[model samples]
Target: MFLSKLALAVMVWTLAACSETSGWNNVIDSHEPKQGESTPSKDNSDTTLASEPVSVGGAFLVCAADDSFEMEAFGCRLEDVTGEKLNSTDIKDGDLVVSNGTQAYSAVAIEGSESFWHWYIAAPLADVSLYTVQYVGQIADILNVETEVQIQHPEKQVSEVTMESPYDDRHLMFVTSIAYQAGQVQNGFNSLASADALCNQHALANGLPTSFKVILSTSTVAAAERIRILYPVYNLEGNLISNPNQFWTNRHLAAVVADKMPSSSEEEEDVTLFEVWTGTSNSGLVKGTETCADWTDNTANEKGNFGMASDARKWVDDGGSRTCESRLRLYCLSQ
Candidate 1:
């Protein structure tokens, strides 16, 4: 059922461009001089692809250590595990990266055709251990690589405040902008099923070293970034800036802009740009979500939430989702 649901989500996403202009989205000019095209660049030579950068902090240990307390506190890791942990860290980019913790570590940051493996699990960043042995592999093939993000940072609208600390004294207000980037991990380019399966296989191969408890928590401070995004003009899913339990995804946020945003080229029009901030607490966990539609005409089961998921309810001033008003307060406009 979950696989079917994910498959449906992929289809819906494929159809997210279910509009007239969709045809014009990725038109390419074949005739245009390949500005930097090498005349014989297509030697079709057998060129060996370089391996990714993998960092192994320590040698393989039999135990896995998880900082469940911190993950729950950040609202990212819902499960908590307490144990004498053994995870690797102190590593550098790329390489068939394996983790040092009780469970194998997964740090994915790309998208394309994924197997069931890649879709169901996420890499927790809190105290992740780098493997001692090196890994060699290919990167996930994806689209929009970066620009496909639902919440984009401002193009060039940021402010500077050098005045004395507003909160350093007895009277102060905490402020920041809540932004999210759409993370797509594709298995083979345009291959969702493949990607999903690959991830599953990988996860199974790298089983969790141990079963530890996962904890959850909340804080008034966590709401800081979310508050800035909630504003008077913005209305997500017909709710005020404050809505909860409504599932929302990066794609949902993109839908909000797709429907509410002015034409991309509309002169002088204001559009909300976003950036994904994963595991904000320096935990290193990558934060993201996905969605799909059932498409059945039954009251018992709606076709889908119509892109209305709990995570979808952003523009919230609480610690739950992103908002704009908080941007005004922090005066740190994203770009």
Candidate 2:
């Protein structure tokens, strides 16, 4: 399901036309001159390619580390003029290349057909940095492509910020715009599944994608494990809430943006201090079984972990618990 969703998300890439002349100050024309045309000359630092340039898209930061966190791979997707994805057989080894200002890395493995192509970097940047990806491979014939990508560490701080919308891609993490009324969280509707349903329902109603899952946990599952890949986590206002690394370490760049619920009456005004049900700790793990009996019990005797929706430092766990009957919101992230 994860891989399939990722493949589907590939369709959302901003067309390479977006790369035409935006922020790409250092231009390198890879297309060769025609028979009667003179070859265009460029600086010695320009990236070399196998043939003329073609269009490629779907560039974003990926948190692809192995168990030991020793391996890092940059990813991209190839698309034709019609916007159809290109298969792995279309490109050979050493065809696709990624270069930071200093070094270059080549494509190591291509996943499923029409899926993300992975380029392995021998020594990745110690910190998050922007990289220029240049591709020279064969489709119908020899072709080249180019785009920029950011490789982020799930536990490191981001030193650079891009002008693109943080929500440019499908990945996001935001608080619910509407808080549950105390009566709405009773027994049958208080489970993890129910919380996820509420999130998706609200997302769809707000015209947002319906791929959200609550950032919650039970005794057996950790909330941090819910999201497999960590793209930039953005809020509803199109701002980055935190870098992938800081999110796990409890170091956030800013408070998360909450979705705004439609106003039906003056009593529905936004609260200054919204509390979100988390049942998880700042570390992304369960908070000592403080999950209201795994989100089943809603009696006053059952206490569940909750976070301050406006506090970046205490967004996950506020070091306090609330009665299961209390009205609260949920933190949700794109699957």
Of the candidates shown, which would achieve the greatest TM-score relative to the real structure?
2
- Whole-model lDDT, model 1: 0.23
Q: Give the deviation of candidate 1 from the true structure as CA RMSD.
A: 30.2
Candidate 2 accuracy as TM-score: 0.49
Please state every model's RMSD to the true fold in angstroms: 30.2, 22.9
Q: How close is candidate 1 to the true structure, as a TM-score?
A: 0.17
Clashing pairs in 2: 54-144, 154-245, 155-245
- Segments of candidate 1 deviating more than 4 angstroms: 1-254, 258-266, 270-335
| Clashing pairs counted in every model | 81, 3
44 in model 1: Cα distance from truth in Å? 58
Cα lDDT for residue 292, candidate 1:
13
